[model samples]
Target: MFDIIIRSATQRKVRSGLTVSGIALGIFALVVMGAMSENFNQTFENSMSLTSDKIRVFAESGMFGGGLTDDKVPDVKRVPGVKDAYGILLTTFDEDQMGMSGKQIFALPPEKSRIALDPVKLKAGRFLEPGDTYQILVGTSIAGEYDLQIGSKLEIHDKNFTVIGILEYTGSFFDSTAAIPLETAQDIYNLEHSLSTIFAVPEEGIDSDILAKRIELNVKGTSTLSPRELQEQASQSLLIFSVITISSALLAAIIGGLSVMNTMLMSVTERTREFGILRAMGAETKDILLITLGEAALLGIIGGLLGIGIGSAAVYLINLWLAGKGIILFAITQRLLVVALLFATVIGTISGLYPAYRATKMSPMEALRYG
Candidate 1:
């Protein structure tokens, strides 16, 4: 039976090749899109890990509203079930300064700052100490890109600060940012006594949602966002990625399936007398059905394999391009490859269903009399 299917496909090389190419194109899209989405999710999760268990307090009642007044940090700490809280000052430094285009900056009190940016191990020098005015910490990415070292001076807001530390490569968003003392940042940004956001941790076993709610109800002119809320937002964002991949995959599949169906339909028509001969030689309906479906599935399998090879090469090239920027944003995993192949095979078999059924329904004598 398999030999017969192989012979049939080989005899109709042009149609078979076209059908396979279509299915392969669909799988290629599927693999490429799937890999990109996975890489995006991974990067996003890594960046979010730091605040995974903490809640963010925003002043002015909206998630991205105006900065919270510096005085709100103590008030938030006093809230019941609140274990600890710290205010963070986040902003973009002058792009022209030090050739850092829109460099992300985070500032917190040297003494109270527990944010290590990925538990950020230090590569050189030491972290900022209390009362260390005009001091800064730089990530490995920035240090390498700018040739910065301990004792290197970075000019921010018309003031030069000595780099006290170079953080280890964290592969997260932090790698592109620099850290500064809280007071220094406030003075430079002219945001005296103002905070971008507050990070709050709940007491052991305290419900984060309840704590967030209580903070919102008690803290006047403030809004609270819990980790759960962040997770929900992440889900929504990831869903967009999924929708994009799935929609493209579906469209590709449909095109590939139609091609397979057309090819198989033509083949069945051309093989009427051929099927009649097989039936007269004691071939069963199921045998004809399997042969037709098998031929289509064979095309699908070949196409899927081709697609995987092409997609893998594309992913490799993409990663190479991103490597220079300290990024690896595409990956083609084993599971994704397996799933792509299975999907291709299923699509091929399904597209041949009608034609296979039609072939089985033919009367041997009538088929023999016809073409």
Candidate 2:
């Protein structure tokens, strides 16, 4: 039976190849899109780890809406269960100052910022120091995008500053920001004592939500959120992207399923006389059905394996290209391969059902006479 199925498929190489290609393309789409989504979720979770035990305090209105004063920092620190507090000043630079648009500038107190506690490893040079007034640390993304390197000089708000370090990518917004001493940021932006946000770490064994609420109540005109809340907000913002990715993959699978059904139906029609001869030679209806299903399953297994290899290679090349730009957008895993292959096989088996049934229902005499 297996030899018959193989011989039949090989006799029509062009049709079989086309059908396999369709299924492979569909599986490839599913694997690639699913891998991208997984990568995003993992990266988001990693970024959240940094703030999991901390609370973010920002103006009740918005980050850009009037912000908060430095005075709020002391009040937040005094809140119950608070371990430490620090302020961050955010400002944007003009196109001339930034050498491009949409880049953000962050002012963090060298001694008090979270980065100083467990510093991100520097790709070059060093982190900011207390006495470093005009020195800045650039995120990996900013450095790659602007072609900036250690010792590079940048003019911001008409003041010259030297790039003293490049930060490693943290899969977070920090990867795109330029950081300088809080005092220097204030002086450059003319923000005498204003802050964009505050970061508060909870005392050991303290609940982050409780600490956040305490800070919000103690410090008026400010809102506070735990790391989990921030992660939920980020997930909501990416909902649309996720939906699109899933929809495209599903559509491809449906198209591939239809192609398989068409190919199987055509193959059954062309093999009517052969099936008739087998039936006359004492082959049962069940045997013919199994042979048809076996052929479809073979196509699926081969196509799925090929698809996994091709999809994995594609993701690797994409990551290599994106790495130079300090970004990662895909993560292919072992589980993804298993699920993709299983999905392809199921789709192939289901698609072959109608054709297999038709082949069995045909009258042997009628098929022989028609042939």
Candidate 3:
């Protein structure tokens, strides 16, 4: 039966190839979209994982909005349950500063920034030390995008700073930032003694929620969010992107299924005489149906495998391009591969049912006469 199915498909190579291509396209969409969504979710989760027992305190107006002064840091630390608070000055790099726009600048006191910077692994050189006012640490993305290296000098507002360190990829926005001393950042931005945000660590035995509430009450004009809250907000913002990708994959699959069904129907019509002859030679209706389904299944398997190969290659090229910019947008996983193959197979099998049924229903004599 399998041999018959193979010979039949081979007999019409063009039709079979087109059908396989359609199914492959669908599987390609599924795998690519799934990989992208998974990568995004994992990056966000990994970033949030680093925020153990800490709450972020920022201006109610948002991170880019008018920021709080450094005085807020002491006020937050004075709140009950708060163990320590550190201020970060956030600003953006202009074309004059880094030959590009919107690259982030994070200003931190060398000693106090370790809590936030601990997650960042140094790729080359050393992190900023106390009294290293004119030194800067660049993120992996920034380093790659700007072709910067250790000892490289960056000019910010007519002042030059040496790149003392390069950080490993953290899979977060920090990957695109330049870290400098807080005072230097304040001077550059001309915001005397002001901060972009504050990070507060709760004392041992104090719940983050309780600490966040205390800080919010004690620190005016600022919003406090536990790490989990921040994670949830980020997830919500990315949900739409996930939905669109998945929806497009599904649409492609549906279209592919329809193409499979159409091709299977044509195959059934063309092979009517063969099915009739088999039935006349004592083959059962179930045998004819099985042959039809087997053909569709074979097409699906071939197409799915091809799709996996193509999708993986596409993902590799995409990652290669993004690497130069310090971004990764795809993570092909075992689950995605398994699901893609199974989805393609199921669609093929289901699509073959109508044509298979029609093959089974043909009267042997009528099919022979019609052929």
Candidate 4:
């Protein structure tokens, strides 16, 4: 049946090409949009998973690594429910100041933050060590972007720092962050003993919410967040993106289906004489319907393959472009590919139903004479 459909399509090359293009376009759009949504979900989960067992302390008012002080750490640790706490310093260096464009610096004390740094697996070199002033650990994306290796220099605030390690693709915040010693960060930013945030671990039996509340009360001028709160924030951030991607992909699918329906209808009309001849030669109405539907499904499959191939490449290119900045905005997964193909096939099968029915309704003698 596939061979027959392909033969027929080859005979009407222009029509088949146009029909395939429509399905391909729709599948392409669906794949890219779906991959982006997948990226958001994956990154969100990775981030949430990284901090699920801990609580985050921040300044009462500020965003993106607030100016929370390390002084709050002792107070937070003194809270009964808190087991351990450590401060992390963060600062974004720009092209003018650091000779690097919009790079975020993630600094922590290595000895105290071992558990904290555990998630940040190294790709090429070593993690930050104690007394490691002027050494940096960068994300894989950034390392690849600048062709950086061990001993490569990164200039920040007119000071040259060496890259000692490249971090694994964490699929979290650190994927886009560069790490250094806590004290080094303070010096370069001129923020002596200042921290951007404090990460805390609650006692074994202590609830994160209760620990957060206790820390807030014990440490003044501070804000606290449990994993649940971060989950809520992530969900809120992805809501708009999810809606837009779903709506656009669905719209494209509908348009593609319509294109298939129109093209199939025309093909049935043009093939009336051929169908009539087949019927006269002992072909049943079911045979006519089967042939027409099979052709439509074949077009869909070809289009889907074309679309998926192109879409996957597009996703790679997009990720590659942002990888330099230590970011990935799209991810192509095997599940997404299967879904795209199935969606295309469904659209094709449904679109062919009406045209197939029309062909079945044609009388052999009348169709042969009319055409």
Candidate 5:
């Protein structure tokens, strides 16, 4: 039976090939899209990590609605279950020419500023320390754009800050940013006690959410944004990317399926007499159906395999292009590859089903008489 199926499938290789290609295309789209999504998620998480492991609170009453007046930080800290809170003003530098102002997060810790960005990847100099009036920790890309190195003097808001460090490349939005002391940033922005944000660490063993809620309710000037809140905002932009990939994959699958169906339908019509003769020669109706079905399945499986190969190659090329542009932050893992292949095979088999079913329903004797 298997031999017969193989021979029959091989005889209709054109139709089978089309079916397989359809499945493969679908799988290819999925794999590429999924890999991109994973990479983006990693990049986003890394960028947020720079803010440290604390919840951010912003003013709700004035400019941008999230800015906190300087006097509000102490009031927010006085809330029950609050350990300590610091004033932060997230903004873009006024002197930036690359339009990096809104793209950066400027965290201000008045005393011992605990904000550190992926310290493990600190490439040159050290993370920002307390009482360092004019020192800044710059990301690699930002550092290169300005030709900065340790001891390089750069001015922010008229005050010259010595470049203390260049953070190693981590694919995040912060890659093009510089961290300044809270006092310096406040002065540059020309705002008094008008902070755009604050960070709070919960007291030992207390629920972070409950504490966050309390902060929201009691802190009149600010609203609390947990890590999850930030992630959701980040993911909204990413959803657009994921949707595009999925749409492309679906379109490929549909086109491929139609081509396979057309090929199979033509083959079935051409083989009418052959099918009629087999039916007359004591072949079971079930056998006739199985043969047609097997042909479809065969096409689907082969096409799926090919699609996976092609899609993987495409992703590699994409990676190479991105690398050339100085973006080597994300990698496609092995698990993603396996899932893509399996999906391709399933799509191929499914696409072949309608054609196989139609072929099986044809009256063998009538088909013979007509063609």
Candidate 6:
């Protein structure tokens, strides 16, 4: 009986092909959109995970006084329930002052800290080392845009600095940044002995937020945040991307599902007499329903598989274009592939249920006599 259904479906080659193609296009768009959004969220999580694991306090008043500072670093470390703490200096240098484009670039210290930022990848040169004067690390995105390389010189505030490293693509805001030593940035920016923030890590099982509040009370003119809060703040920057990806994917999936239903309904109408004949042959309503539903499921599976293939290819092409711009973070893992295929299959199967039930209820005598 299943083979007969397949044969009958093949008999309407043109309609079947068109229906399958429509579903494939819809699922393709949905899968790509879903994967793109998920990737961004995952990237956000990865970038913030390490940052958040450590509580950070910043001075909230003076240039750096209003954010985190070294003055409170030791006290925060000594706070009850605190485990470890470190101080960081943040400042920016304007390149245009040195005859380069006047872009404000951020710099960080290369000291071991509670909240350490590890560069994702390096394309050229090396990271910061103690006493390494006039050196800089830049993101690949900036490297291409500025046509820079190892040993290339960048002017920072009327000072010539050599490019030391090109950071690898990490799908976060950090991918487009430049980093340097704390002292180097301070001198270049003319900020004296001032730091941006301090970070702390809690002891095992300690309530980080509670610890933060305790430290804040001890240290005047400062605020503290647990890792979770920092991540939310960081992810907030990418919230728009998440919304667009999810909304677009859902819309595509809905359109595809509706198309599947429309095709199933048309198929059922065309096969009304066939359903009547089956009823005359003693086929139960459930059997009729199963047959129609099964056919729909098979169509969905095919379309979904095709969609996955097409969508994956599209992602690869997009990545290729981005790679030329110094970003190569678009990765399609096995899990994503399987999930997309499964999503397509479920949408197809669910959409066909109503039409299949309507076909099962067709009366043999009535269907036979009707047009």
Best by TM-score, which number?
A: 3
The residue pairs in collision within model 5 are: 16-299, 20-299, 20-303, 21-303, 59-66, 70-193, 92-101
* Pairs in clash, predicted candidate 1: none
Q: How many angstroms is residue 370 displaced in model 6 relative to the true structure, after the best TM-score fit?
A: 3.3
Worst 10 residues of 5 by lDDT: 110-119
Worst 10 residues of 1 by lDDT: 94-103
Each prediction's TM-score versus the true structure? 0.85, 0.84, 0.88, 0.83, 0.75, 0.77
Residues 1-371 of candidate 2: C-alpha lDDT, one tens digit per residue: 79988888788999989988988898889889988987777666766775566789998987778768888888998998988888988777455555344457878897764353244567888888878999988887778876889999878778888999888877665676788888888877788888888988788999888778878888899998788788788888667676788679867876887788899999999989988888899889889988888888777777788777888899999988877765667889788889889988888888889999999998999888765
Reference-based lDDT, residue 203, model 4: 87
Better of 2 and 4 by lDDT: 4
**Candidate 4 segments whose C-alpha is farther than 4 A from its true place:** 1-4, 62-67, 93-103, 123-126, 190-194, 274-288, 317-329, 361-369
**Model 6: runs farther than 4 Å from truth?**
60-106, 112-115, 118-126, 138-160, 165-177, 187-196, 201-207, 231-244
lDDT digits (tens) for residues 1-371 of candidate 4: 56777788778889889888989998999999999998888877886887788888998985454568778888888989888899988777554546244457778986654577676677878877787999888876678767889999988668888999888887876666778889988987888988888989888988898889888888898888887887787788888887899679968976888888998999999989988899899998778878999888888888889889999999899878877665678889889999999988888988999999999999999888866
For model 3, residues 301-352, the per-residue Cα lDDT tens digits are 7788888889989998998998886667798989889988988888888889
Please identify which of the two predictions, 3 or 4, would achieve the higher lDDT against the true structure. 3
Cα lDDT tens digits for candidate 1, 1-371: 89999999999788888888898898888888888877667656766875677888898655346658888998999999999888888887545555344357889888764453536678899878898889998877667666788999988778998999888776566776788998899998888988888888899999999999999888888888899998898889898987888688768877988899999999999999999999999999999999999998998889889988898899899878756554566767777888889998998999989999999999999999886
Query: Which stretches of candidate 3 lie above 4 Å from their native place?
Result: 93-103, 156-159, 282-286
**Candidate 2 global lDDT:** 0.81
CA lDDT of every candidate: 0.83, 0.81, 0.84, 0.83, 0.68, 0.72
Between which residue pairs do clashes occur in model 3?
none
Global CA lDDT computed for model 3: 0.84
lDDT of 6 by residue, 1-371 (tens): 68966876677788777767877887788667766766667666766753556787877564444444456778778888878776666544443345132223655555541135553667767777767768877876667766889999977667788888887766664565677676777786776556777767789998887887887798888777767677677678678776787577767766777777898899899889888888888999888877788777777777888888898888889878866655544557677678767877777788889999898778789978767
What is the Å distance of residue 171 in model 4 from its true position? 3.9
lDDT of 6 at 45: 74
